[model samples]
Target: MNLLFLTFTFPLIGWLLLSFSRGKWSENLSALIGVGSVGLSALTTAFLIYQFNVNPPEGGVYTQVLWQWMSVDGFAPSFTLYLDGLSLTMLGVVTGVGFLIHLFASWYMRGEDGYSRFFSYTNLFITSMLFLVLGDNLLFLYFGWEGVGLCSYLLIGFYYSNRNNGNAALKAFIVTRIGDVFMAIGLFLLFQHLGTLNIQELMVLAPQKLVAGDTWLWWATLMLLGGAVGKSAQLPLQTWLADAMAGPTPVSALIHAATMVTAGVYLIARTHGLFLLTPEILELVGIVGAVTLVLAGFAALVQTDIKRILAYSTMSQIGYMFLALGVGAWDAAIFHLMTHAFFKALLFLASGAVIVACHHEQNIFKMGGLWKKLPLAYASFIVGGAALAALPFVTAGFYSKDEILWEAFASGHTGLLYAGLVGAFMTSLYTFRLIFIAFHGEAKTEAHAGHGISHWLPLGVLIVLSTFIGALISPPLAGVLPESFGHAGGEAKHSLELSSGLIAIAGIALAAVLFLGKRRFVSAVANSGPGKLLSAWWFAAWGFDWLYDKIFVQPYLLITRLLGNDPINSSIGLIPRLVRLGNSLMSRTETGNLRWYSASVAGGAVLLLALLLILN
Candidate 1:
C-alpha cells in the first residue's frame, strides 16, 4: 500500500470535489466527503504504523519518491514521502484528530450557508498539513506550509461579510507571512552553503559541513525559529490568535488541534539536527516557550470570549512543547503535541456545542447554569479541562506536562521550571474560570440544545483518549522516536510530581474561591484600578497588538499616507516623459518630407563646422 500517497491524496480529492461542488453537493454529502477523506487517510496511517512495526526500517528511515518534481542547475527535488518515527507520529495525530473535528463540524455547521465551502477548506488544510509532515524535501514542506496558511486565511475568514472576521484572518495571514519571509531566507542560505533542499540530505550535510556555533548555522536556525514562533503563535507573533476567535468554533478547533498551529513544532522537531548546532538558539527556544506560556495563561484569564480563552490556552500549551524541545526532550514535546491534539480538539468542539446552545453567545460571562442543559458538552469539557490542567496522574496532559518540567529542572533551568509551575497554576485557574462561570450559577438566558450523534460521538472518543492515552503512550514513545534525535536526562522524581500536582490543586481551589459562588468578585476585581490594568493588558494580549502598531503599523501607514499621491514616483516617472519629448523632437527630422530631412541634416553639419572653427 502506498500509504503516503493515499493519505494526502484522499483529502486533496475531497477538497477539489467540494471546491467545484457548485451546489451539487448536498450538506450531508459534503460532510460525508470531508469526514470520509480524512477517515480513509487515518486508516492508511494506522496500516503504515502496523507495517512499520512488522518490518522496521533497516537504517531507521523509509522514503519513497513517486517522481522527480523539479530539476534545475543540478538542484533536483523529488516528489517524495519520507516516513520515520516522527512523521508517523504526526500522521496519526493529524488524521485522527482531523477526522474527529470534521465529524463535529458536520453537526455544528448543519443548515448553515456555505457548509460545503467550510468542509472544502477543512480538507485542504488536512492535505497541506499532511504534505508538510510527510514531505522529503524542504521546498515541498514549505509548499505545504504556505498551503496551510492559505487555507487558514480562507477558513478563518469564512464569514467574510463580518469586518472583524475578515481582519482577524488577514492578521493571521500577514503575521505568519512575516515569519515565512525569515524561513525563506534561511532556506536560501542553506541552499547557498549546502547546495541542497532535500530535508534528509540537508540534515546529514549541515552537521558535516558546518561546525557547531558557526555563525551561518546560528543565523540559519534563528531564522527558522522566527518561522516556528509565528506558526506556533509563540511570543511576539501570538497577538493574531486571540482575534482568530472571530471565526466559527469548528475552525478554531481545527486550528488548535490538528493543522496549521502545530506545524512549527513539527518543523523544529523534523530539523532537529540543524538546531543542535546552535546551542544558544536551542536554549532560546526553551525560554521563548517558557515565558510565552505564562503570558498566554495570563491572557486566557481575562478573555470573556470562550473561544478566545481557549485560543490563549492553545498558545500556552504549545509553549510547554517548546520548553520540552529546548530541554532536549524531543519525544516529550511530540508526546505533548499528540495528547494536546486530542484534548484541545475535544475542548474546542465541546465549546462549540456550548456556543450553539447559547445561540452564538461567546462571552462566558453571559452564560450560566448550562451544565444540566448540555450534559454531553459539560462532560466533554470536564474531561478536556482535566487534561488541560493536567490533573495529577489521571490525565494525558499530566504525563506530557510533567515530563517537560522534570526535564527543565533536571537540565538545570530551575527558573524555567518555576515559571512553568506558575503557568500550570494559571492554566488551571483560567480553565476552571470558564467552567465555573459558564456552566454553573443562575441562568443568564435560554440556550437551546443542538443534539446529534455526530456531536457526542467525537467528544466521547476524544474524552477517552485524553483520559488514558498519556499513560498508555508514554512508555512506548521512547522506542518510536529514533535514538539519534534526543532524549531528556535524569530519572523522574516523585517529589517534583507531587509538587506540580499540589500546584494544580492550589489553582483549582483559588479559582473556586475567586470565581465560584456569586462571581460578583470577578467583576469587582476587574472594576478595580489594578484589576482594570491587568485585565486591559491581558485583553490586548499584553499590548503586542499596540506595540506592533506603534513600531510597524503606524510607521507603514504614515509612509503610505504621505506617499498616497506618489510624488516621488511621479518625478522618477518623468524620465519616461522626457524621453518621449526627446523622441518627439527627433521625430521632427523625419517629418515624412525629404526637404525637411535635408534641411535638418544641413543644420547639423553647419553646427559641427562652427564648433571646429571655434576650436581652431
Candidate 2:
C-alpha cells in the first residue's frame, strides 16, 4: 500500500518541481525528471505485480483505503486503490509503455522551445492516468478521468503558438465532455440504487441487490457505455481523436495508444457486473464496437498523415477490445488491451522517430524506401505491423485479437462476428499498406537520412516485448473469472488452435496480396470503378464521421451562431439600452426649479379632489 502511494506521489512531485522550475531548469534536466518519475512508478508497479503474484489474494482482488472521501445517508465513496489481475494488467501497460514514450519524447522533443513545459504536462498526464487505473471508487475514478482529460487538453495544445493545435485541444475537450456528462449521470444512478461507489462492493451487490432487467439498469448501462464510447474514441465521438494528431507524436502515443483512451475499457471491465444485468445493452455494446472498428479501419486507409492513420487505427483497435467486453469476454478484452499497448506505442514511437528523421515531414507520400537508412525503425514498425495485422502464431496481437474474434463468434452474435472478421482483414491490409508504401517503395524525397541510437533502443525493447507477451495470455486469462462470477463454464467458447489461426492466416494473405503482391494492380483497382468505391469507403470511413458531423457539429454550430448574434449579444446590449432609456425618462422628470415643481404638484392634487367630488 505504501509503495502504491509512492507510485502516484512521485509523478505529482515531478509535476510540482517542473511547474515551479519552469524556465529555470535546463531542458535536459527537466526531461529527465519528467520521464524519470514515470520510470519510478513503473518500478513500483513491477513490485506490486510481484507481491500480488506471490500472495495470490482471495478472489484475485486487493483493495486499500486511504480515507473516507464522501459519505451521505447510506452511500459511501472512498479514496482507495484496487489491485486485481485486471488493474495490475492496466497498470503495467500504462506505466511501462508510458515511461518509454516519455523517454522517446526526451530525444524527439529536444531543442523545442517549450521543452520544460512539455515535461511538466507529461508528468501530470502520468499522474492522472495512474490515478485513473488505481482508483477503487467511481468518484475517484471520475477525478482521474477528468485529470486525464485536462492533461490531454494541456498537452495537445502544448504548441499553443499554433492556433490549430489550440482548436484541436478544444475540440477534444468538448467531445469527451459529452460522454463525461453521461458517465456522471450513470454514477449518480449507481450510488442511488446500490448505495456505494466502492467498485468491489458494487460488484458484489449488483448481482443480488439490484433488480435485473429493470429500465433504470438499462439506462445506467447505456449511459456508462456512452461515456466509454467517448473516452475510447468510438464512433460519433471519434472525430476528436483523429484531429488530436495535432499534438506531438509522443503525446499522441501516450494519450491515444497507452493511457487516456483505454480508460473506457477499464471502466467497462471494472463494472462488468453492472453490464451483465442488461443483455440488450450488452448487444448494443458489441454492435457499437464492431461498427467503430470497421469505420475507423476505413478512415485509416484514406489518411495521408502518418499520425492520423495511427490515430484512426487506435480507434479501430480499441473497438475490438470493446467488442470483446460486450460479449462478456472481459478478460479477453483486457488481454488485447495489454498487447495493444506494446504494439501501438511501438508503432507511434517508431513513426515519431521517422518523422523526426525526416525533418518533421509527416506525409507518407513524401516518404519512401528508407529501410536501409533506419533499419531499427523499419524493424520496429514491422513488428508492430505484424502484431496489428495479427499474423498467425508469432505476434502478441494475434493472441489477443484472435481471442476476441473467437469470443464474438461463440457468443452467438453472428452479425458482430462477421463485422469483426471483416475489420480484421481491413486492419491487416491498411497496416502493412502503410509499411510497404512508406518503407519498401522507391524513395520519394530526400530528408534527414537516419535516426540516432536512442531511437532504435526503445524500438528494440518494444519489439522484443510485443513478440513474447502474447503467450502469457494465450492459454486463457479468464479461467478464474467465470468461477468467481458463478457463471457456467464455457459460456464463451474460443478455439486458440484452429478457428483463430485460420482467420489470422486469411487476414495476412489479404494484406500480402494487396500491399506486397501486385502492388500496381492494387493501385490500379483503387483508381478503377470498384477500386474507387473501396477508396471512397476508406475516405469517408463509410460516412460515420460525416454522419456525426451533420447530426451534432453542424447543428451545434448553427445554434451557436444564432445565440451569439441574437440571444446572447442582444440580451447584453438590451441591458445598456434599458439603462439609457431610464436615464432619458428621469432627465425629463428632473426639469426645472423647486417653485415650478411645487406648483405642478398642487394643481394635480386640486384636479384629483374636483374629480372625486363630481363622481360623488
Candidate 3:
C-alpha cells in the first residue's frame, strides 16, 4: 500500500534503460528489461489491489501525495496518486495486459531491428497511462496524457524506415492532438471559472457552483467530449486508427486494447460529474457512440487485412464503451473496457501469430485452411472472436455488452439501443466472416506456425480471460462511480439479453452461410453493382478518409504547395532584398575607381546643399 509508486517507478525505469541502450543491447537483454519492467509493474498493481480489497481505503479512495508540484497565490496542485476502484481497474489493465503484450512482442519481434527501441516506447506508454489513470489532479493527468500521446507517436512509427508507417504515426498524433487541444481548453475553462484543476475539488465544486445545463458547464463538457471523441477514435476523428496498423502487431494490441484508444473512455468516466450537468452533451456522447459504432461495424465487415479488421472492431467496441458512458452506465462502460482489453488483445496477438505463420500475408482471402496449421491462433481467434461477438453465457463480451444494451433500453434511449443491437449483429457476422474465410477455405499459402513459451503463454492466458472467467472479475466501481441509472430486473433485462444473444448467434450463422463454403454467393454479391458500390464505400470506411482527404488533407496540401516558397517569408524578405540591392549598387559605385568615388561624394554634397538652400 505504501509502495504504490513502485508501479510507476518500475515501468519508468524500464523505459529509461531501454531507451538509453541505443539498440546496442542484446535482444535477450532488451526482452528481459521490457517484459520484466511491466511484469514488476503488474505485480505491484496486483499487490495493491489485494491490499485495497483486504482493507478498503477511507471514503473508498486514498490519495498519496508525493510532492507539491506548484504553488501560487492559493493555487496548489501536487503530484498525487488517487487510488480508487476506477483507477485500480485501469491500472490492472494497463500493467497486466500490457505486460502480456510486451512478453508476446519479445517473440514476435525477434530478429527485427530496433527491438529494444520498440520496448522503450511501449514501456513509456505504460508509465504514462499509469499516471493518466492515477493522477489526482487534472493538470497531472494532462501531463500524463501528453506523455502517452508522445510515446504513441514513437511506437506507431517504430519502423521509421517506411514512409507509410511514419505517415500513420503522424496521422494518429495530429488527429489526437486536435482532441487534446480541445480538452486543454476545457481544463482552462474549468480552472478559470472554478479556480482549480483538482479533479476531486472540481467534482464537489462544480455541482455547488453550476446548475443543470449551465452554459459554462455545457461548453466545457463539450470540449472535453471533443478530446474523448478523438482519443477513442470515434466519428469524424476516427480515420487514423486503421492506418495505425502500419506498426507491428504487438504495438497494435497495446494501443487499441489496453492503453491509447481506451484513454478517451477513461477520461469521460473520470469526468462524469462534469458531463452530468450538461445533459445535452451527455446525450450527444451517446449519439456519437451510436453513430461511430454502426459506421465502424459496417467498415469492419469489408476489411480484408486481419489487423485492419481488428482495428475497426476496436473502434466499434470503443463506441460501445462510449455509449455506455453516455447512457450513464458508468460501471458498465468500465467493465466493458476491461473485458475488451482481454479479448481485443488476444485477437491482435493471435493475428500477429497468424501473420508470421502465413509468411506475412495479411489479407484474409490470401490465407486459408490455417486452423490445422496454427491451432493455438485458431483457438485464440475463435475464443476471442466469440467474446467479441458476445456469444451467450460462455464469453466475457456477452456479460458486458448485454449490460450496455439493457442500460440503453431501460434508459429509454430506444434509438441507441437499436444501434447497439445492429452493431452486435455486425460484430458477430464479420468476426466469423474473417474466421470462416481465413481458417476454413483451402490453403492459399504455406504456413508454419511458430512455437515458443513466449507466444503460447500470452495467448493461453488471454484465451481464458476472453471467456466467462473474465466477466466474473468485476470492477470495484460501486462507490468510485455514480450508480448506473438504467437498471432493470426481471423479464425485461432477461428478454433484452436473450434478444441480443439470439441476434449474435443469428449473425454467426449467417456468416457461415455466406462464407463457409465456396464463398461464391458472397463474392457474387460483392461484385454486383449495388454490392460493389456499398462494399467500396464501406471498405473505404464510408469515405470518411476520402472525404477528409478531399475536404481537409488535399486542401491543406494544396495550401502548403501554394505556400511552398513561404510567401509570407518571401514578402518579409523584400526589405532585406531591397537593402541587398542597394548595397550591391553602392558596392559597384565604390569599385576603387577614385574618379567615380569623388564624383559620387561631390554629387551627394551638391544635392545636400541644394536641399538646404531650398529649405532656407
Among the numbered candidates, top lDDT falls to 3
Q: Could you arrange the candidates by lDDT from highest to lowest?
A: 3, 1, 2
Better of 1 and 2 by TM-score: 1
- State in Å the error of residue 472, model 2: 2.9
Over the stretch 1-616, how does candidate 2's per-residue lDDT look in tens digits? Answer: 3467877888899999999995689987897789889899889988987787787667776677788876777666777888767777788888888888988888898888888889889888888988888898888999999999999999888889999999999989999999999999998888888787777788788887767788877898999998999899987677789878888999999997789899999898888888888888887888888999988888888777889888888999999988988888777788888899889999999999889877898998788887877787889889898888787778888877877777766667678778887788778777877887788767876656445555666787789878756446432235334422212325344343355557656766766676663477777877899878877877765676678779888999999877777876888999999999999997887777898799889999999999999999
Candidate 1, residue 499: Cα displacement in angstroms equals: 0.6
lDDT: the better of candidates 2 and 3: 3
Rank list by TM-score: 3, 1, 2
- Candidate 2 stretches greater than 4 Å from native: 57-59, 449-454, 473-480, 483-519, 529-534, 564-578, 582-616
TM-score for candidate 2, residues paired by index: 0.89
Better of 1 and 3 by TM-score: 3
- Which residue pairs clash within candidate 1? none
| Candidate achieving the largest TM-score | 3
lDDT agreement with native, every candidate = 0.88, 0.82, 0.94
Model 3, position 157, has a per-residue lDDT of 90
**TM-score for each of the candidates:** 0.91, 0.89, 0.97
Q: In angstroms, how far off is 202's CA in candidate 2?
A: 1.3
The deviation in Å at residue 2 for candidate 2 is 3.1
Model 2 score (lDDT): 0.82
TM-score of candidate 1 versus the correct structure, residues matched by position: 0.91
